[model samples]
Target chain A: MKQQQQAFALPPGAPSIDAMIAAENRRARKRLWTALAFMAPAIGFVAIFLLLPVFFNLYASLTQWAKFSGLNQFAGLANYQRLASNPKFYDATWNTLIWVGVSFVLPATIGLSLAMLVRGVKGEETFKSIFFLPRMFSATAVGVVWYYVYANEGIINSGLRAVGLGDLANRWLYESHLATPAMIVTHIWQQVGLMMVLLLIGLNALPSEPMEAAKVDGASRSQIFRHIVLPLLMPTLIMVTTVSVLAGFTSFDLVWVMGRDFPNRSTLTLSVNQYWESFRAGYWAYGSAIAVVLGVIAMSISWSLGALQHRLDKR
Target chain B: MQKKLSKLLAAVALGVTFTTAAASADPVTVFHDKPFYQSGWDGLTATAKKDGIDLNFSAYATDQFQAYIQSSLMSGDAPQAFTWWNGTKLKEIVDSGQLAPLDDLWAKKIASGEYDASSAAPFTVDGHIYGMPTGLNRWVVLYNKALFEKAGIAKAPATWEELIAAADKLKAAGTTPFNATIQDGWRGFVWFQELLLRTNPEAYAALNQGKLKYTDEPVQNVFKIWTDFYQKGYFTDATSQEEPLDFARGKAGMYLFGDWVIGLVEKGGVKAGTDFGAFIMPNVDPSLPNAVIVEGAPIVITKAGMENPDVVKFTDWYMSENAMNSWATDPGLYAGNLKAKTPNPIIAELAKIAADGKYTSVTRYWEASPSEIVLPAVEEFNRFMTNPSEEQAQKAMANIEAIASQYWASKQ
Candidate 1:
């Protein structure tokens, strides 16, 4: 490090990030570029599987394909136009809105509460392990387990009957209005640990200096959290929010697993409908349209959330 | 001791290697759709192998086959033949020039009064045949004998009013009368078919074809009965919760399902005769005897497979003397061959039901809809199950019409 510093002198003002990063790594920029060149295989994989497909899907939504005959025709805006008029397109949009929003808000809030409780608690590790165990299981398995718990004659109903409230018990996932909420609660339970873990990482990264300053200044715990420490934790919050939003938006396995054939199909997000319409029902053109809309909505939502978080982080 | 240990180790190693090598021979690439049927298929594979066919038996859940069958047909290395449904689904495959019409080969047998060509009717289009029907299904309302006995009901309800009253009696006795699982749009379709048959059986064919609009009153009647039953709690949370089969298994009073359900019931360790009895889902018009819809599967020989002498021989033998008896053993299914009959007593009851005169026959809605309409209608059916207010149901139906107009009109 000292050898690199002898060759490089900083400008008078605070060094830019590029300069510091460049200073940290003493290699020439060309060698760095060569290192990136060596990483071309991984970059190619991301381009093919992720970026190229996304771009192709964007193109497909604008076009049309018959399920049986395959894609040779291009329908342009007509697919999107039909989507706007389709009620299920709207149903999926509403469900997506609910799912993504709850997916972020519920898990984040639970995580915050959990992290706050665990930080000062004894056996923090044990609580975190207990809460996070479900995260290790696939969402599909979690969904099935919960389905049994919430079934008519399953654990929940059995408890209700034991307490002489059997008449009051009804199918939790049966009623469409309640179905979405029920699924969301199960999601939040399974997801809270992740939120807690991410926040704990951020909490651990907190420097003692700023927190001690707030304490000495006669600020309460909440005040310290609201001001100096929270401000310092802004980047972590943004990252957590960004990941949660993406996971929430693309969550097909949980919803599909929970409500395999749930009534009104209103519990259906754009992904589920896209699959059923294309695969089960053989409406590839319409399904492709749904998929495109879903992709747009998901990308836009994540981008917007991340931008908001970044602005707050900058503050 | 060391010498004995080495001898035992050497012998164990030799046994495993020999077994592994023998077990790893070429598989007979069978693309079956029913794993339930595949239990019996394990028996028939020997017959398949006798003609030098390697056993690569592959099976899919019913839904996956519906999605991938087209692609399978186009692939050059597709399975020799698969268990495809014997209806508009099969007809579509044959039309694509992908499926080989087995008519020319099966013709002599059809003429000689061996194969029931009538059962092959759904697999026929332009008078060309595609495959044989495996299960002769007769849709009926199966009731629990214990539930009926507990309710003091001596016989299966013979009329619509009686059935409703029977349901009411069971409800009073604290049991859900109907075992319905409508989380799938198709379950709601059961009541829809039942109501349609009871009210307006004659209108079914037109309804199946593009000739009938979904908004027609007869179709509306199907949903009305569905809504009414749903509101009454005649069914306990079938639409939202799964395991309606569990409801039947757990002794929910009655189930309006096909004969395929017998295998499921049996798997649940429920006795066929003692646990349940079959009767047509009665409609109020006692004068008009009720009918049940028959949905079935068939074997489609690829056109290219026709040129191969070995494939033709396999097909010929598969259609011959003892194969029908072989296929019937598992669930005791009635074969497409007129010469075959099930020995099972439960299936014998369905056989009697099939002989009734006023049968309102139409292909399944998924197969019958003009290509684009199926998905939208599925959505409509799904939306309806949510206990959507009348307004939402109307919106759903209207959207279905729009899909119909948008897709079907273009085709015409």
Candidate 2:
């Protein structure tokens, strides 16, 4: 009775099931090869330009090498050991933490608030464009302009004095305590535009149904934002946070330019410190160690955030 | 099929063009950091052309030059020759074993009485000459003559007391006494160097050589004097624009700068000897002999570059009297060659001072100290200038000592 059933399923003049399976497998194989061929160039580019350099940098971190000199000797963990003992390393790390905190909080808060306030407002595009204008200038140019603005007699001080607040006008770049904060203000000015744009896109893309339903249910605006809008924007918020964290860890150009003229490099972040150690001080091995530490920190943060994002997405 | 064929043909054509270009004569590439000297370099290129050697000259902004040279060297693609600062900065490159000892070339020049062995002292490492001197500059206090006259100063100050008196006169006259620019991080060390040299020249040299500690009494005295100057408001505001500008416009009475500022002064329509005059920074202690800071940019050849005959030939020609003379004529530079005549009157006066044995010539602190020490120490000095506290000075010294110790120990 089973054999009769199988024969009925096959029908007259039909190929065997095994033959059908083999034909499907052949098609899949062909599809895979074509896909791989299409992806080869991109994969090769990432491997050569990104992955290979990262591995090379890791290798360099293990050696006592100076630029323009042969990498002749292996130093094991000596560079990392020095990094652990160096006060400058600690200072740089501390500064990096402050940078990350400020970068995340200031930009995200301002960006989200602006996005909410500007929604459905008159001249919305113009207001957005005005805020986004700073993003068009290169970081170096922004740094140079801000450097003069913070000068002892720069616009900030001059304006304060003009408003009869002369006592408040202080040397902005000269004081170690004020330098980093002053620099952070400049960075926030430059970065707020990006954060606002990203969040604005996320806000616009959100489904209107949930928000409208919450409104009909007599939910307050803040309550609705916290319950519905915030939860839905989690993925984008996570992405924005990761980018801000990365930028904090790698902040160099603006700080370098603003602080280059100042003798006290207390304003140096990890990236700037690495460049100084490797290029200026010729401590390439030590610099590579700093770089490796920074890379690991950045990756760890990204990984943790990505996992959180995945769990949220599943929910 | 036609598109694929055309792509293949295009690739082949591109490969052939690259091969043909590479097959042409290999030029001797030279790197420099002097963007202001295009005409001067043009003259040198003319000399290189006469020798049948194509010269590819590249110039970087001063701040970027060191890193550019370093990366090029590490990549094993360095130019044939490049301009570098003398003293410890040159030693850093020499220690990397990337330089070719120019002993043979230097010996020939010394024998011809064109080059002085003493002048090559800064470029020597392990008893082998690693570089040829390009230009020499002396650090001096350039005072605006008209400004000084208006302030009732009959002549240049000859002592620290006189200098203070002059400053008071200038301040009363509503002009800044001294125009110092820390806009360039390296320039922050100028006052520190000048003060240290005035206090104790020997200790200053030892400090630069990493033998004397920054906490030493001589160094402390330097800080004390510098702090006093800051307190008295003898210096222009810390935020003032770069030197020679303030001095040229008569907004500032004096500027302590290298001879290179003379060109800028000339450009600002101020005559060197007439409108402005150079004077040695007076010794703080009358018991000490006069001292001056001297610096020279050196041109160094790479080891691989020496293997190329054209590079070797070009280097030799570049250091010759004819080439240096051409450079001196255009840029008004004082050649490192002892025999090269100085047509610039102010440079002639400086040359005379340098030739005299009474005044000791010390290497500028920026180039004399190891980069590890200088990089941090200058920052500390910059801070100290603004804050002007003993505690800050002590902290700065300690920081410098810590870096210097680590660097020197690792070297050993």
Clashing pairs in 1: A261-B183, A264-B382, A264-B386, B27-B54, B27-B55, B27-B56, B28-B54, B28-B55, B28-B56, B29-B56
The number of the candidate with the highest TM-score is 2
At residue B222, give the lDDT of candidate 1: 71
In candidate 2, the second chain superimposes onto the true chain B with a TM-score of 0.87
TM-score of each: 0.83, 0.88
Q: Which docking category, incorrect, acceptable, medium or high, applies to candidate 1?
A: acceptable
Q: Which DockQ value does candidate 2 get?
A: 0.49
Tens digits of per-residue lDDT, candidate 2, A38-89, equal 9999999999999998998888889988556757689999899999998779
Across residues B1-412, which tens digit of lDDT does each residue of candidate 1 receive? 9999999999999999999977875353557777767766875676556656654467886667766775555444456667776656666666667667787767888787776555666677788878756666767777888888898778999888889889999988888888866654555566655677677766666766666667777776676777777778787555444443564555478887777777666666666776777787776577775556676667777766676555676677667656666666676466556566564667766664454435654455555555456655665666566553566566666777766766657868
Give me candidate 2's TM-score against the actual structure.
0.88
In the range B248-360, model 2's lDDT, one tens digit per residue, is 88868989988877877777778888888888889878998777788878888989889988888887787778777767766357666667666467887887766665677
Q: Residue B337 in candidate 2 has what lDDT?
A: 68
DockQ for each candidate? 0.37, 0.49
Query: What's the CA error at residue B408 for candidate 2, in Å?
Result: 3.7
Name the top lDDT candidate: 2
